[model samples]
Target: MTDCLFCRIIAGELPSKQRHSSDLVIAIEDIAPQAPLHLLILPREHIGSAADLRDTPAHAALLARMHAVAAELANEAGYGDRGWRLVSNVGVEG
Candidate 1:
C-alpha cells in the first residue's frame, strides 16, 4: 500500500487539501473536481475496493464513517438542499 497514491497522501508523503480525518478514514478534495463541492473520502488503510472489505464490525463501521463524513462535507459545502452523489471508486481500473 506504500505505493498507493491515497496511501501516500494519508502517510504525509504527498500533499493534499484534507477536509476531514479520523482513525478510520480521511477526506481530501478531489484534484480534478467534477462538481463545485467534490471530495474523495478514503480509508486510512488501503483496500482496492468494497470487495476488499471484511464482513466485520470494524469494516462496517468504516463504511458508515465514510458516508457520515461525506454528508458532513456536502452539507458544509452548501449541498445539503441540493443533495450530493457519492461515487465509490479505487485503483486504476476503478
Candidate 2:
C-alpha cells in the first residue's frame, strides 16, 4: 500500500487540496475536476477499489461516513439545495 497515491496523501507525504480529514476518511478536491465542485473522498486505509469492500460492516461504516462527509461538504459549498452527484470508479476500467 506504500505505493498507493491516496495512502500517501492521507499520510501527509503528498500535496492535496484537502477539504476535510478524519480517522475514517480524507476528502480532497479533485485535481482535474470535471464539475465546478468535485471532491474525492477516500478511506484512510487503502482497499484498492469499491469492489474490494465485500459486504463487511466495517466497510459499510466507512462508506456511510464517506457519504456523510460528502454531503456535509456539498452543503458547505452551497450545493446542498441544488444537489450533487456521487460517482465511484471500480476495477481496471476506472
Candidate 3:
C-alpha cells in the first residue's frame, strides 16, 4: 500500500489541496478537475475501491459516512442546490 497514491496523500507523504478531513474520511480537491467543483473523497483506510468493501455493517457504515461527507462538502461548496456527481473509477482502464 506504500505505492498507493491516495494512501501517500492520507499519510501526508504527498501534498494535496485538502478541503476537509475527519476521523473517517478526507476530502481533497482534484488536481485536474473535470467540473467546477471536483473533490475526491477518500477514506483513511486503504480500501482498493468501493467494490473492495464487503457487505457488512462496518462497510455499510463507512459508505454512509462517505456519502454524508460528500453531501456536506457539496453544500459547503455551493453545489448542493445545483447538485453534483459522485464517481468512482474501477480497474486499470478506469
lDDT string for model 3 (1-94, tens) is 4999999999999999998899888999999999999999999999997778898998888789889999999999899999888888877787
Query: lDDT tens digits, residues 33-68, model 2?
Result: 999999999998889989889788999999999999
**C-alpha lDDT of all candidate models, in order:** 0.89, 0.93, 0.90
Candidate 3 residues lying further than 4 Å off, grouped into runs, are: none
> What is the Cα-based lDDT of residue 33 in candidate 1?
90
Poorest lDDT segment (10 consecutive residues) of candidate 3: 85-94
Pairing residues by index, what is the TM-score of model 2?
0.94
Best-to-worst ranking by lDDT: 2, 3, 1
| CA error at residue 30 for candidate 1, angstroms | 0.8
Q: How many pairs of residues collide in model 1?
A: 0
Candidate 2: what lDDT? 0.93
